[model samples]
Target: MKKPQKAIVTFTNPTVKERLKPHLYSMMIKPWRMIKNTLMLTGAFVWLLLLLVCLYFYSVLSKVPDLEKVPFQHVREVAVESVQSKIESKTKLKEYQWVGIDNVNRDLLYAIVMSEDGQFFSHKGVNWDALISAIGENIKRRELSYGASTISQQVSKNVYMRSNSKSFSRKLSELFTTRELEKHLSKNEILELYLNVAEFGPDIYGVKHASKYYFGKSPADINAAEGAFLAIMLPSPRKYHYSIFQNKHLAPRHQRKLRRIFSDMLYKEYISPNQYQSYLKWNYFFN
Candidate 1:
Protein backbone atom coordinates (compact mmCIF):
# COMPACT_ATOMS: atom_id res chain seq x y z
CA MET A 1 0.00 0.00 0.00
CA LYS A 2 2.94 2.47 0.77
CA LYS A 3 4.59 1.73 -2.58
CA PRO A 4 1.34 2.49 -4.40
CA GLN A 5 1.07 5.92 -2.62
CA LYS A 6 4.59 6.83 -3.69
CA ALA A 7 3.59 6.56 -7.37
CA ILE A 8 1.67 9.93 -7.22
CA VAL A 9 4.60 12.40 -7.89
CA THR A 10 4.16 16.23 -8.38
CA PHE A 11 4.57 17.42 -12.04
CA THR A 12 6.34 20.77 -12.99
CA ASN A 13 4.08 23.76 -13.99
CA PRO A 14 4.13 24.50 -17.76
CA THR A 15 3.63 28.26 -17.08
CA VAL A 16 6.85 28.36 -15.01
CA LYS A 17 8.82 26.70 -17.77
CA GLU A 18 7.43 29.18 -20.30
CA ARG A 19 8.42 32.07 -17.96
CA LEU A 20 12.05 30.74 -17.74
CA LYS A 21 12.39 30.22 -21.54
CA PRO A 22 13.30 33.87 -22.27
CA HIS A 23 16.00 33.90 -19.55
CA LEU A 24 17.52 30.68 -20.95
CA TYR A 25 17.56 32.09 -24.47
CA SER A 26 19.20 35.31 -23.27
CA MET A 27 21.97 33.42 -21.52
CA MET A 28 22.65 31.46 -24.72
CA ILE A 29 22.98 34.75 -26.73
CA LYS A 30 25.02 36.66 -24.11
CA PRO A 31 28.37 36.50 -25.93
CA TRP A 32 26.87 37.53 -29.27
CA ARG A 33 25.13 40.45 -27.56
CA MET A 34 28.42 41.54 -26.02
CA ILE A 35 30.11 41.38 -29.41
CA LYS A 36 27.33 43.42 -31.04
CA ASN A 37 27.49 46.06 -28.28
CA THR A 38 31.27 46.30 -28.64
CA LEU A 39 31.02 46.73 -32.41
CA MET A 40 28.39 49.47 -32.00
CA LEU A 41 30.59 51.29 -29.47
CA THR A 42 33.64 51.07 -31.75
CA GLY A 43 31.69 52.47 -34.73
CA ALA A 44 30.43 55.36 -32.61
CA PHE A 45 33.96 56.09 -31.43
CA VAL A 46 35.31 56.12 -34.97
CA TRP A 47 32.57 58.53 -36.11
CA LEU A 48 33.31 60.81 -33.14
CA LEU A 49 37.01 60.87 -33.99
CA LEU A 50 36.29 61.81 -37.60
CA LEU A 51 34.01 64.63 -36.46
CA LEU A 52 36.77 65.95 -34.13
CA VAL A 53 39.33 65.97 -36.96
CA CYS A 54 36.97 67.92 -39.22
CA LEU A 55 36.25 70.38 -36.43
CA TYR A 56 39.95 70.94 -35.81
CA PHE A 57 40.61 71.74 -39.47
CA TYR A 58 37.60 74.06 -39.55
CA SER A 59 38.75 75.88 -36.44
CA VAL A 60 42.20 76.44 -37.85
CA LEU A 61 40.76 77.79 -41.09
CA SER A 62 38.21 80.01 -39.32
CA LYS A 63 40.96 81.95 -37.50
CA VAL A 64 41.89 83.77 -40.71
CA PRO A 65 39.65 86.84 -40.56
CA ASP A 66 37.88 88.47 -43.46
CA LEU A 67 40.47 90.79 -45.03
CA GLU A 68 38.35 92.38 -47.77
CA LYS A 69 37.76 95.62 -45.88
CA VAL A 70 39.59 95.22 -42.57
CA PRO A 71 42.73 97.29 -41.99
CA PHE A 72 45.61 94.90 -41.34
CA GLN A 73 46.13 95.51 -37.61
CA HIS A 74 47.63 92.01 -37.66
CA VAL A 75 50.74 93.47 -39.27
CA ARG A 76 51.06 95.95 -36.39
CA GLU A 77 50.77 93.10 -33.92
CA VAL A 78 53.64 91.21 -35.61
CA ALA A 79 55.69 94.42 -35.73
CA VAL A 80 55.19 94.88 -32.00
CA GLU A 81 56.48 91.37 -31.39
CA SER A 82 59.56 92.15 -33.52
CA VAL A 83 60.06 95.43 -31.65
CA GLN A 84 59.81 93.63 -28.30
CA SER A 85 62.38 91.10 -29.42
CA LYS A 86 64.75 93.88 -30.44
CA ILE A 87 64.34 95.59 -27.08
CA GLU A 88 65.06 92.38 -25.25
CA SER A 89 68.17 91.77 -27.36
CA LYS A 90 69.37 95.40 -27.03
CA THR A 91 69.49 95.82 -30.82
CA LYS A 92 68.40 98.86 -32.78
CA LEU A 93 64.93 98.20 -34.14
CA LYS A 94 64.48 98.51 -37.88
CA GLU A 95 61.63 100.35 -39.55
CA TYR A 96 58.33 98.73 -40.57
CA GLN A 97 55.58 100.24 -42.69
CA TRP A 98 52.31 99.24 -44.33
CA VAL A 99 52.43 100.34 -47.92
CA GLY A 100 49.79 100.06 -50.60
CA ILE A 101 50.38 97.95 -53.72
CA ASP A 102 50.26 101.14 -55.76
CA ASN A 103 53.09 102.60 -53.71
CA VAL A 104 55.44 99.70 -54.49
CA ASN A 105 57.69 99.63 -57.55
CA ARG A 106 56.17 97.95 -60.61
CA ASP A 107 59.47 96.29 -61.35
CA LEU A 108 59.62 94.90 -57.84
CA LEU A 109 56.14 93.47 -58.27
CA TYR A 110 57.10 91.87 -61.57
CA ALA A 111 60.29 90.47 -60.11
CA ILE A 112 58.52 88.93 -57.11
CA VAL A 113 55.76 87.52 -59.29
CA MET A 114 58.31 85.89 -61.52
CA SER A 115 60.70 84.69 -58.85
CA GLU A 116 58.29 83.57 -56.11
CA ASP A 117 55.03 82.55 -57.82
CA GLY A 118 54.75 82.66 -61.57
CA GLN A 119 51.10 81.55 -61.44
CA PHE A 120 50.13 83.78 -58.53
CA PHE A 121 47.36 85.50 -60.47
CA SER A 122 45.82 82.27 -61.72
CA HIS A 123 46.12 79.84 -58.80
CA LYS A 124 43.56 79.76 -55.98
CA GLY A 125 45.92 79.04 -53.08
CA VAL A 126 47.97 76.12 -54.37
CA ASN A 127 49.87 75.22 -57.52
CA TRP A 128 49.22 71.53 -57.99
CA ASP A 129 51.71 71.11 -60.83
CA ALA A 130 54.57 72.68 -58.96
CA LEU A 131 53.55 70.90 -55.77
CA ILE A 132 53.51 67.55 -57.57
CA SER A 133 56.91 68.28 -59.10
CA ALA A 134 58.30 69.29 -55.73
CA ILE A 135 56.94 66.10 -54.19
CA GLY A 136 58.56 64.01 -56.91
CA GLU A 137 61.85 65.81 -56.44
CA ASN A 138 61.77 65.33 -52.67
CA ILE A 139 61.08 61.63 -53.12
CA LYS A 140 63.95 61.27 -55.58
CA ARG A 141 66.34 63.23 -53.37
CA ARG A 142 65.27 61.22 -50.29
CA GLU A 143 64.91 64.47 -48.38
CA LEU A 144 62.09 66.79 -47.41
CA SER A 145 63.89 69.74 -48.98
CA TYR A 146 61.89 70.85 -51.99
CA GLY A 147 59.29 73.55 -51.29
CA ALA A 148 56.42 74.73 -53.47
CA SER A 149 54.97 77.34 -51.14
CA THR A 150 52.85 79.91 -52.90
CA ILE A 151 52.66 83.57 -51.84
CA SER A 152 49.30 82.98 -50.17
CA GLN A 153 50.72 80.01 -48.27
CA GLN A 154 53.73 82.06 -47.18
CA VAL A 155 51.41 84.80 -45.90
CA SER A 156 49.43 82.21 -43.96
CA LYS A 157 52.59 80.81 -42.36
CA ASN A 158 54.04 84.24 -41.54
CA VAL A 159 50.82 85.58 -40.08
CA TYR A 160 49.13 82.62 -38.39
CA MET A 161 51.73 79.88 -37.89
CA ARG A 162 55.28 79.71 -36.56
CA SER A 163 58.08 79.42 -39.11
CA ASN A 164 60.21 76.93 -37.17
CA SER A 165 58.05 73.83 -37.47
CA LYS A 166 58.52 71.59 -40.50
CA SER A 167 55.84 69.10 -39.52
CA PHE A 168 52.96 67.68 -41.55
CA SER A 169 50.54 69.29 -39.10
CA ARG A 170 52.12 72.70 -39.69
CA LYS A 171 51.79 72.26 -43.46
CA LEU A 172 48.16 71.20 -43.11
CA SER A 173 47.44 74.28 -41.05
CA GLU A 174 49.17 76.44 -43.65
CA LEU A 175 47.08 74.89 -46.43
CA PHE A 176 43.82 75.46 -44.56
CA THR A 177 44.80 79.05 -43.72
CA THR A 178 45.80 79.73 -47.32
CA ARG A 179 42.39 78.57 -48.56
CA GLU A 180 40.74 80.82 -46.02
CA LEU A 181 42.88 83.76 -47.10
CA GLU A 182 42.06 83.18 -50.76
CA LYS A 183 38.38 83.04 -49.93
CA HIS A 184 38.58 86.37 -48.08
CA LEU A 185 41.07 88.42 -50.10
CA SER A 186 41.72 89.14 -53.76
CA LYS A 187 44.99 88.22 -55.46
CA ASN A 188 46.15 91.84 -55.56
CA GLU A 189 45.23 92.30 -51.91
CA ILE A 190 47.19 89.22 -50.95
CA LEU A 191 50.20 90.55 -52.88
CA GLU A 192 49.85 93.96 -51.21
CA LEU A 193 49.72 92.49 -47.72
CA TYR A 194 52.71 90.23 -48.43
CA LEU A 195 54.76 93.14 -49.77
CA ASN A 196 53.94 95.19 -46.67
CA VAL A 197 54.80 92.49 -44.14
CA ALA A 198 57.55 90.36 -45.73
CA GLU A 199 60.85 90.41 -43.81
CA PHE A 200 63.81 91.90 -45.69
CA GLY A 201 66.76 92.00 -43.25
CA PRO A 202 67.58 91.45 -39.55
CA ASP A 203 65.21 94.25 -38.59
CA ILE A 204 64.13 95.41 -42.02
CA TYR A 205 60.47 94.70 -42.82
CA GLY A 206 58.55 95.61 -45.98
CA VAL A 207 59.72 96.66 -49.43
CA LYS A 208 59.24 100.30 -48.48
CA HIS A 209 61.63 100.08 -45.52
CA ALA A 210 64.12 97.93 -47.43
CA SER A 211 64.08 100.32 -50.40
CA LYS A 212 64.64 103.37 -48.21
CA TYR A 213 67.38 101.73 -46.15
CA TYR A 214 69.39 100.27 -49.04
CA PHE A 215 68.84 102.75 -51.88
CA GLY A 216 68.06 105.83 -49.81
CA LYS A 217 64.98 106.24 -52.00
CA SER A 218 61.29 105.44 -51.73
CA PRO A 219 59.97 102.18 -53.19
CA ALA A 220 58.23 104.23 -55.85
CA ASP A 221 61.55 105.65 -57.02
CA ILE A 222 63.50 102.38 -57.24
CA ASN A 223 64.57 101.11 -60.69
CA ALA A 224 64.49 97.65 -62.30
CA ALA A 225 68.03 96.82 -61.20
CA GLU A 226 67.32 97.86 -57.62
CA GLY A 227 64.01 96.00 -57.66
CA ALA A 228 65.64 92.80 -58.94
CA PHE A 229 68.35 93.11 -56.29
CA LEU A 230 65.79 93.57 -53.50
CA ALA A 231 63.73 90.64 -54.76
CA ILE A 232 66.88 88.45 -54.91
CA MET A 233 67.79 89.50 -51.36
CA LEU A 234 64.47 88.17 -50.10
CA PRO A 235 65.74 84.55 -49.89
CA SER A 236 68.51 85.47 -47.41
CA PRO A 237 68.17 89.07 -46.35
CA ARG A 238 70.73 89.21 -43.52
CA LYS A 239 73.48 87.46 -45.48
CA TYR A 240 72.83 89.42 -48.68
CA HIS A 241 72.47 92.67 -46.78
CA TYR A 242 76.01 92.38 -45.37
CA SER A 243 77.28 91.01 -48.65
CA ILE A 244 75.91 94.02 -50.53
CA PHE A 245 77.66 96.29 -48.04
CA GLN A 246 81.00 94.44 -48.20
CA ASN A 247 81.08 93.62 -51.91
CA LYS A 248 79.13 96.58 -53.34
CA HIS A 249 77.70 94.11 -55.90
CA LEU A 250 75.31 91.17 -56.12
CA ALA A 251 76.66 87.71 -55.34
CA PRO A 252 76.79 85.06 -58.07
CA ARG A 253 73.73 83.34 -56.63
CA HIS A 254 71.82 86.59 -56.76
CA GLN A 255 72.79 87.06 -60.41
CA ARG A 256 71.61 83.53 -61.21
CA LYS A 257 68.29 84.12 -59.48
CA LEU A 258 67.82 87.36 -61.39
CA ARG A 259 68.44 85.52 -64.64
CA ARG A 260 65.80 82.96 -63.68
CA ILE A 261 63.38 85.77 -62.92
CA PHE A 262 64.09 87.39 -66.27
CA SER A 263 63.53 84.11 -68.05
CA ASP A 264 60.19 83.56 -66.33
CA MET A 265 59.11 87.13 -67.04
CA LEU A 266 60.02 86.71 -70.67
CA TYR A 267 58.22 83.37 -71.00
CA LYS A 268 55.08 84.83 -69.46
CA GLU A 269 55.23 87.80 -71.82
CA TYR A 270 55.48 90.06 -68.80
CA ILE A 271 58.49 91.52 -70.58
CA SER A 272 59.38 91.89 -74.26
CA PRO A 273 62.29 90.19 -76.04
CA ASN A 274 64.11 93.53 -76.13
CA GLN A 275 63.44 94.07 -72.41
CA TYR A 276 64.69 90.57 -71.60
CA GLN A 277 67.89 91.26 -73.56
CA SER A 278 68.29 94.57 -71.77
CA TYR A 279 67.80 92.91 -68.39
CA LEU A 280 70.37 90.24 -69.27
CA LYS A 281 72.89 92.94 -70.20
CA TRP A 282 72.18 95.05 -67.08
CA ASN A 283 74.76 94.52 -64.33
CA TYR A 284 73.91 94.85 -60.64
CA PHE A 285 77.13 96.79 -59.90
CA PHE A 286 77.33 98.96 -63.00
CA ASN A 287 73.81 100.36 -62.66
Candidate 2:
Protein backbone atom coordinates (compact mmCIF):
# COMPACT_ATOMS: atom_id res chain seq x y z
CA MET A 1 0.00 0.00 0.00
CA LYS A 2 2.81 2.43 0.94
CA LYS A 3 4.67 1.60 -2.24
CA PRO A 4 1.58 2.29 -4.24
CA GLN A 5 0.89 5.58 -2.44
CA LYS A 6 4.31 7.12 -2.77
CA ALA A 7 6.08 6.41 -5.93
CA ILE A 8 8.12 9.58 -5.48
CA VAL A 9 8.14 11.18 -8.92
CA THR A 10 11.53 12.55 -9.89
CA PHE A 11 11.75 15.09 -12.73
CA THR A 12 14.83 14.80 -15.00
CA ASN A 13 16.15 17.65 -17.18
CA PRO A 14 15.95 17.05 -20.97
CA THR A 15 19.05 17.06 -23.18
CA VAL A 16 20.02 20.46 -24.64
CA LYS A 17 18.92 19.62 -28.11
CA GLU A 18 15.68 18.08 -27.02
CA ARG A 19 14.71 20.96 -24.66
CA LEU A 20 15.64 23.67 -27.24
CA LYS A 21 14.16 21.87 -30.26
CA PRO A 22 11.26 24.30 -30.90
CA HIS A 23 13.40 27.42 -30.31
CA LEU A 24 16.24 26.02 -32.47
CA TYR A 25 13.83 25.19 -35.27
CA SER A 26 12.29 28.65 -35.07
CA MET A 27 15.71 30.33 -35.18
CA MET A 28 16.79 28.27 -38.14
CA ILE A 29 13.59 28.85 -40.12
CA LYS A 30 12.99 32.54 -39.29
CA PRO A 31 15.96 33.87 -41.26
CA TRP A 32 15.07 31.79 -44.30
CA ARG A 33 11.46 32.97 -44.17
CA MET A 34 12.58 36.55 -43.74
CA ILE A 35 14.89 36.24 -46.75
CA LYS A 36 12.13 34.76 -48.88
CA ASN A 37 9.77 37.56 -47.91
CA THR A 38 12.41 40.20 -48.61
CA LEU A 39 13.07 38.72 -52.03
CA MET A 40 9.37 38.73 -52.86
CA LEU A 41 9.04 42.36 -51.80
CA THR A 42 12.11 43.35 -53.84
CA GLY A 43 10.78 41.60 -56.93
CA ALA A 44 7.42 43.34 -56.58
CA PHE A 45 9.16 46.71 -56.19
CA VAL A 46 11.27 46.14 -59.25
CA TRP A 47 8.27 45.20 -61.37
CA LEU A 48 6.39 48.25 -60.14
CA LEU A 49 9.30 50.49 -60.98
CA LEU A 50 9.51 49.02 -64.47
CA LEU A 51 5.81 49.52 -64.98
CA LEU A 52 6.07 53.12 -63.83
CA VAL A 53 8.92 53.79 -66.23
CA CYS A 54 6.98 52.31 -69.12
CA LEU A 55 3.93 54.37 -68.24
CA TYR A 56 6.01 57.54 -68.05
CA PHE A 57 7.54 56.93 -71.43
CA TYR A 58 4.12 56.22 -72.90
CA SER A 59 2.62 59.35 -71.39
CA VAL A 60 5.42 61.51 -72.66
CA LEU A 61 5.15 60.16 -76.16
CA SER A 62 1.38 60.38 -76.15
CA LYS A 63 1.47 64.07 -75.30
CA VAL A 64 3.12 64.92 -78.59
CA PRO A 65 0.16 66.22 -80.58
CA ASP A 66 -0.43 65.18 -84.14
CA LEU A 67 1.82 66.83 -86.71
CA GLU A 68 -0.51 66.45 -89.67
CA LYS A 69 -1.44 70.11 -89.83
CA VAL A 70 0.91 71.78 -87.35
CA PRO A 71 3.19 74.38 -88.86
CA PHE A 72 6.78 73.23 -88.86
CA GLN A 73 9.18 75.05 -86.57
CA HIS A 74 12.93 75.45 -86.38
CA VAL A 75 15.01 73.53 -83.90
CA ARG A 76 15.10 75.47 -80.67
CA GLU A 77 18.85 75.09 -80.48
CA VAL A 78 19.30 76.78 -83.87
CA ALA A 79 16.85 79.49 -82.95
CA VAL A 80 18.69 80.29 -79.73
CA GLU A 81 22.03 80.46 -81.47
CA SER A 82 20.56 82.68 -84.15
CA VAL A 83 19.32 85.11 -81.56
CA GLN A 84 22.69 85.12 -79.84
CA SER A 85 24.53 85.71 -83.10
CA LYS A 86 22.25 88.59 -83.99
CA ILE A 87 22.81 90.17 -80.59
CA GLU A 88 26.58 89.78 -80.71
CA SER A 89 27.03 91.02 -84.29
CA LYS A 90 24.47 93.83 -83.90
CA THR A 91 22.87 92.72 -87.18
CA LYS A 92 20.18 90.41 -88.36
CA LEU A 93 21.63 86.92 -88.54
CA LYS A 94 18.60 84.70 -88.63
CA GLU A 95 17.08 83.69 -91.97
CA TYR A 96 14.46 80.97 -92.44
CA GLN A 97 12.06 80.05 -95.21
CA TRP A 98 10.01 76.92 -95.25
CA VAL A 99 9.66 74.84 -98.40
CA GLY A 100 7.61 71.76 -99.13
CA ILE A 101 9.21 68.53 -100.19
CA ASP A 102 8.12 69.25 -103.76
CA ASN A 103 9.88 72.59 -103.66
CA VAL A 104 13.16 70.90 -102.72
CA ASN A 105 15.35 69.56 -105.49
CA ARG A 106 15.16 65.85 -106.17
CA ASP A 107 18.92 65.71 -106.48
CA LEU A 108 19.40 67.14 -103.00
CA LEU A 109 16.92 64.67 -101.61
CA TYR A 110 18.72 61.77 -103.22
CA ALA A 111 22.08 63.11 -102.17
CA ILE A 112 20.98 63.50 -98.59
CA VAL A 113 19.49 60.03 -98.51
CA MET A 114 22.65 58.55 -99.98
CA SER A 115 24.97 60.50 -97.75
CA GLU A 116 23.19 60.56 -94.41
CA ASP A 117 20.83 57.61 -94.18
CA GLY A 118 20.87 55.17 -97.04
CA GLN A 119 17.89 53.28 -95.62
CA PHE A 120 15.84 56.28 -94.74
CA PHE A 121 12.92 55.24 -96.88
CA SER A 122 12.99 51.64 -95.78
CA HIS A 123 13.87 51.69 -92.11
CA LYS A 124 11.60 52.55 -89.23
CA GLY A 125 12.46 55.04 -86.51
CA VAL A 126 15.69 53.18 -85.83
CA ASN A 127 18.21 51.33 -87.97
CA TRP A 128 19.14 48.29 -85.98
CA ASP A 129 21.74 47.00 -88.41
CA ALA A 130 23.58 50.28 -88.56
CA LEU A 131 23.29 50.63 -84.83
CA ILE A 132 24.81 47.22 -84.29
CA SER A 133 27.60 47.93 -86.73
CA ALA A 134 28.30 51.25 -85.07
CA ILE A 135 28.41 49.57 -81.68
CA GLY A 136 30.91 47.00 -82.88
CA GLU A 137 33.08 49.65 -84.46
CA ASN A 138 33.01 51.83 -81.39
CA ILE A 139 33.84 48.88 -79.18
CA LYS A 140 36.71 47.79 -81.37
CA ARG A 141 38.08 51.30 -81.65
CA ARG A 142 37.46 52.10 -77.98
CA GLU A 143 35.85 55.38 -78.94
CA LEU A 144 32.36 56.85 -79.32
CA SER A 145 32.89 58.35 -82.72
CA TYR A 146 30.22 56.52 -84.65
CA GLY A 147 26.43 56.81 -84.52
CA ALA A 148 23.60 55.01 -86.27
CA SER A 149 20.99 57.71 -86.02
CA THR A 150 18.24 57.40 -88.60
CA ILE A 151 16.62 60.44 -90.15
CA SER A 152 13.83 60.08 -87.63
CA GLN A 153 16.26 60.11 -84.76
CA GLN A 154 18.10 63.09 -86.20
CA VAL A 155 14.84 65.01 -86.45
CA SER A 156 14.10 64.19 -82.84
CA LYS A 157 17.52 65.42 -81.78
CA ASN A 158 17.22 68.61 -83.80
CA VAL A 159 13.70 69.50 -82.79
CA TYR A 160 13.11 68.33 -79.26
CA MET A 161 16.11 66.63 -77.74
CA ARG A 162 19.10 68.67 -78.84
CA SER A 163 22.03 67.88 -76.59
CA ASN A 164 25.63 67.36 -77.60
CA SER A 165 26.52 65.65 -74.36
CA LYS A 166 26.86 61.91 -74.73
CA SER A 167 24.68 59.73 -72.53
CA PHE A 168 22.39 56.74 -72.67
CA SER A 169 19.48 58.73 -71.24
CA ARG A 170 19.69 61.31 -73.98
CA LYS A 171 19.75 58.62 -76.62
CA LEU A 172 16.72 56.94 -75.11
CA SER A 173 14.81 60.20 -75.07
CA GLU A 174 15.73 60.81 -78.68
CA LEU A 175 14.51 57.37 -79.67
CA PHE A 176 11.25 57.89 -77.88
CA THR A 177 10.62 61.21 -79.51
CA THR A 178 11.68 59.86 -82.87
CA ARG A 179 9.23 57.03 -82.63
CA GLU A 180 6.50 59.44 -81.73
CA LEU A 181 7.30 61.64 -84.69
CA GLU A 182 7.34 58.75 -87.08
CA LYS A 183 4.08 57.49 -85.75
CA HIS A 184 2.33 60.79 -86.38
CA LEU A 185 4.02 62.09 -89.52
CA SER A 186 4.36 60.71 -93.00
CA LYS A 187 7.76 60.05 -94.57
CA ASN A 188 7.37 63.05 -96.86
CA GLU A 189 6.31 65.22 -93.96
CA ILE A 190 9.27 64.14 -91.88
CA LEU A 191 11.63 64.84 -94.76
CA GLU A 192 10.04 68.22 -95.31
CA LEU A 193 10.42 69.14 -91.66
CA TYR A 194 14.03 68.03 -91.64
CA LEU A 195 14.91 69.96 -94.78
CA ASN A 196 13.14 73.05 -93.56
CA VAL A 197 14.76 73.04 -90.12
CA ALA A 198 18.27 71.85 -90.95
CA GLU A 199 21.00 74.46 -90.62
CA PHE A 200 23.08 75.23 -93.69
CA GLY A 201 25.22 78.00 -92.18
CA PRO A 202 25.72 80.01 -89.03
CA ASP A 203 22.26 81.50 -89.28
CA ILE A 204 20.82 80.18 -92.53
CA TYR A 205 18.11 77.61 -92.00
CA GLY A 206 16.27 75.49 -94.57
CA VAL A 207 16.76 74.93 -98.30
CA LYS A 208 15.24 78.25 -99.23
CA HIS A 209 17.78 80.35 -97.37
CA ALA A 210 20.63 77.96 -98.17
CA SER A 211 19.80 78.00 -101.87
CA LYS A 212 19.70 81.77 -102.07
CA TYR A 213 22.78 82.29 -99.91
CA TYR A 214 24.96 79.71 -101.62
CA PHE A 215 23.83 79.89 -105.24
CA GLY A 216 21.38 82.78 -105.59
CA LYS A 217 18.68 80.34 -106.68
CA SER A 218 15.66 78.58 -105.29
CA PRO A 219 15.90 75.11 -103.77
CA ALA A 220 13.99 73.58 -106.69
CA ASP A 221 16.51 75.03 -109.13
CA ILE A 222 19.61 73.49 -107.48
CA ASN A 223 21.67 71.42 -109.90
CA ALA A 224 23.10 68.00 -109.21
CA ALA A 225 26.58 69.32 -108.48
CA GLU A 226 25.24 72.07 -106.28
CA GLY A 227 23.00 69.64 -104.45
CA ALA A 228 25.92 67.31 -103.86
CA PHE A 229 27.99 70.19 -102.57
CA LEU A 230 25.28 71.15 -100.12
CA ALA A 231 24.88 67.59 -98.91
CA ILE A 232 28.63 67.24 -98.38
CA MET A 233 28.82 70.52 -96.50
CA LEU A 234 26.08 69.35 -94.15
CA PRO A 235 28.53 67.46 -91.97
CA SER A 236 30.32 70.65 -91.01
CA PRO A 237 28.55 73.59 -92.53
CA ARG A 238 30.05 76.34 -90.39
CA LYS A 239 33.57 75.09 -90.81
CA TYR A 240 33.14 74.55 -94.54
CA HIS A 241 31.52 77.95 -94.88
CA TYR A 242 34.52 79.61 -93.32
CA SER A 243 36.92 77.55 -95.36
CA ILE A 244 35.09 78.27 -98.58
CA PHE A 245 34.91 82.00 -97.87
CA GLN A 246 38.51 82.35 -96.71
CA ASN A 247 40.50 79.84 -98.73
CA LYS A 248 38.15 79.12 -101.65
CA HIS A 249 38.77 75.39 -101.20
CA LEU A 250 37.34 72.56 -99.15
CA ALA A 251 39.73 70.70 -96.94
CA PRO A 252 40.86 67.25 -98.00
CA ARG A 253 38.42 65.72 -95.52
CA HIS A 254 35.46 67.53 -97.02
CA GLN A 255 36.62 66.61 -100.50
CA ARG A 256 36.66 62.99 -99.49
CA LYS A 257 33.15 63.22 -98.09
CA LEU A 258 31.94 64.86 -101.27
CA ARG A 259 33.45 62.07 -103.33
CA ARG A 260 31.85 59.53 -101.07
CA ILE A 261 28.46 61.15 -101.52
CA PHE A 262 28.84 61.14 -105.27
CA SER A 263 29.96 57.53 -105.22
CA ASP A 264 26.98 56.52 -103.13
CA MET A 265 24.64 58.44 -105.38
CA LEU A 266 26.06 56.70 -108.39
CA TYR A 267 25.94 53.30 -106.74
CA LYS A 268 22.29 53.83 -105.84
CA GLU A 269 21.54 54.89 -109.42
CA TYR A 270 20.37 58.25 -108.23
CA ILE A 271 22.71 59.70 -110.83
CA SER A 272 23.83 58.34 -114.20
CA PRO A 273 27.42 57.35 -114.84
CA ASN A 274 27.88 60.50 -116.87
CA GLN A 275 26.47 62.62 -114.09
CA TYR A 276 28.81 60.97 -111.65
CA GLN A 277 31.73 61.67 -113.91
CA SER A 278 30.66 65.23 -114.31
CA TYR A 279 30.42 65.73 -110.56
CA LEU A 280 33.83 64.14 -110.11
CA LYS A 281 35.30 66.83 -112.31
CA TRP A 282 33.11 69.61 -110.98
CA ASN A 283 34.96 72.47 -109.33
CA TYR A 284 34.09 74.00 -106.00
CA PHE A 285 31.54 76.76 -106.42
CA PHE A 286 33.26 78.90 -103.82
CA ASN A 287 36.27 79.36 -106.08
Candidate 1 residue lDDT tens string, 171-263:
887887788779877788789867866767767777887888778889888766667777877777788777874478766777788889888
Candidate closest to the true structure, highest TM-score: 2
Best by lDDT: 1
Which regions of candidate 1 deviate over 4 angstroms?
Answer: 1-38, 51-55, 66-94, 136-143, 243-245, 248-253
Runs with alpha carbons beyond 4 Å of true place in candidate 2: 1-7, 13-27, 44-48, 51-94, 137-144, 162-165
RMSD of each: 5.5, 4.4
* Predicted candidate 2 versus true structure: per-residue lDDT over 95-173, tens digit per residue: 5556778988899888877777888888878999999999999999998889988878877776665457567667777
List TM-score per model, in order.
0.74, 0.78
Model 1: pairs clashing at backbone N, Cα or C within 3 Å: none
lDDT of each: 0.76, 0.75
